[model samples]
Target: MTTTLDKRPPGAHARPTPPSKGRGFNLLRYNLLGGVAGWLWLVVVLLPIYWIVITSFKVQADYYATNPLAPPTNPTLDNYRFVLENDFVRYFINSVIVTVGAVGPAVLVSFMAAYAIVRGSAASRFLRGVNGLFLMGLAIPLQAVIIPIYLIIIKIQMYDTLGAIILPSLAFAIPLSVLVLSNFVRDVPKELFESMRMDGATEWGTLWRLAFPLTRPALVTVTIYQGLTVWNGFILPLILTQSPEQRTLPLALWSFQGQYTINIPAVLASVVLTTLPILTLYILGRRQLLSGLTAGFSK
Candidate 1:
């Protein structure tokens, strides 16, 4: 037998071996408790949604006769038809208008204010004070100041108008929007700002070209959040507006429930209809919203 001479460097370390596949399997198996909890939570959340959708398709008689969780034997469109014929279109349009009007201005103003605060707070005391004010607003719940808001709306002669709803929504939206957006703006590296300045970019130009694109995820997050708040808003609409023509979806849904108190299927159908737009919006911006929220929280 011949001994082989060692053919290696004097002190080179050996590479560590990769993890075995079974190790990953063992780790997953150890997390069975978390997996079980997650599944249970998912079922809890989805069960109500499933019932709402199934019940919307049921007739009033079947809804009473069948199991609450059971699917309809003979689904009907009459409930949806009844809801639609009862000024659903008008309420939808009002919601759209209020949502767009309020969210647009709120996001725009908040974004600009956030950028300003991030870029200029070092040199400006007013901006710092404004930021503090915004943070303070977060602690002020809508319920606390709703009476003052109502009085102001009345004083301004905006009572019972869509403007009444839009103005307060805009005001309430700003505080949280500013908080979320300013954090995202702060996360941007100073080097980028310096580079833009060295290239002779004006503040406005830098804002629109650089910061705006980078902060789009944050914008989408804010937009979705504020839109949902405004869309599902009941109190403002309830207190500010009374006319059927001026009613938003939430208020309309309340009236619909009262009108069809005995018709459970129609009530459920109206609920489904009111929820669809919001659900669609969430679906569209879900990825951006999640990423934005993750980034916001991580920072």
Candidate 2:
């Protein structure tokens, strides 16, 4: 006791540890309010989807007779059959064409523009100006410009055609795509770009080999976002196309509703079918979409 030897390791000091909070105190800190809010929101969203699925399976009579949310006693494929038999296949194909046509070119052009803006904005006032133009486009709502767009489509003799829908959709899609893509492109390390240049890689070569690979999550995000916009696009298809043959899914769904006003089951069935492709696409690209969004926000 009088000559107590120092027992601690030479480099190790006795550090004070954080006092332990009991389980009750830890539990008190859990976000109960947030958890409750999230559950409420989940129910709000899923309830209608639940009703839609259940109602789609019911017969027209059963739709009126049974509870709206109840599963059908005799679930029939008749509603789906009815929808498919009514040139649903043609409208589906038209949607595919319009979505692909618009999204492909829009993404391609936006990617190139974004790459140029990020790479050249420092030295080029024009590139910076172009970026400003894109930012301004985000402020311009489609409704405000629809009249002008319609007039241009008429002037170009593209009105009442899928091309009319695709062109406007492509134009509208570009602003947001460039905005998202440019941020991702700018996040690439300047050192890596320098290394590429030192290795005699052209900007074009580096864009594809380096930037493209690194920024693929953003590309997928843009593609899916724009694709969904074009896919469920009601106003453009309605104004731009007049023929039944030119109708995309949203326009087709509207027409389907008008044609079968009393057949709620059939209407919901078409809604489900129309949504399937989009749902499939989202499922496929959801990971990339989330990662892209996270990366964007983090920066």
Candidate 3:
């Protein structure tokens, strides 16, 4: 390599020093501080997960006698035994049915509605209004309309049935899902959609064959998000269903929390068990879930 040194005198501004810093900050120190904060956050987030898993295995007697954070000296299956005998599995099944039932229709209907809103907004004033309404729904707190929801269920004779939970959860899931999917759909290239039309493809044909494949990531994102919401839902299950068989996982936690006393280990076990499926779901779809959520922000 050949070297060419500047022949300018020492005080001749030195070619502006090439900015030995970016924006006048010490970048390495800033990055190290950020790394420390991130690790601290990881520890904070993992601590509860650790405690719940460890506590779930401890014998109820040993749980009280030993330090709260200590690993069980004699870890036993007794709590799992107790949970199963009391129909924890049935609770799991009921949650599955409710979650699947609610999320399926929610995702499907939301996709269709979002497609219509995004594609038709240019031609139809009404659909633009409809999209506005859905975005508006994001502001309505769930607690505010919950009383009306409960009353509607009672009037329809759906109270105490799984339908009571499914119907409302589906309704609430739609607004957010439509908002997300519509953004994803709208971001689709205009040329691609027009090319399908040029080939004599019907609107529905274009939707399934073209829009769907492109938006699959957003769909998976919505499914996992809505499924988690409906799976762990407590408020709807609490207010709508009364029978033990009707109970979802959150409501079923009462099986471990007695009126006067609580089985802490068993309760934690139920929590850990209930969360496992959702954790698995997130693990599988986490990439798509995160990407879909931030899909349009880049533009």
- By TM-score, the best candidate is 2
Scanning candidate 2 in windows of ten residues, the lowest lDDT window is 1-10
| lDDT tens digits by residue: candidate 1, 108-222 | 9999999999999999999999999999999999999999999999999999999999999999999999998998899999999999999999999999999999999999999
Worst 10 residues of 1 by lDDT: 1-10
lDDT value, candidate 2, whole model: 0.93
Number of clashing pairs per prediction, in order: 0, 0, 0
TM-score per candidate, chains pooled? 0.90, 0.90, 0.89
| lDDT of model 1 at position 53 | 90
By TM-score, the candidates rank as 2, 1, 3
Cα deviation in Å at residue 36, candidate 3? 1.8
Q: Name the regions of candidate 1 deviating beyond 4 angstroms.
A: 1-30, 297-299
- After superposing all C-alphas onto the true structure, candidate 1 shows an RMSD in angstroms of 4.2
Error of 2 at 98 (Å): 0.9
Candidate that beats the other on lDDT, 2 or 3, i.e. the better one: 2
Q: 280, model 1: CA deviation in Å?
A: 0.7
Q: What is the C-alpha lDDT of each candidate?
A: 0.94, 0.93, 0.88
Candidate 2 local lDDT, 62-144, one digit each (tens): 99988888899999999999999999999999999999999999999999999999999999999999999999999999999
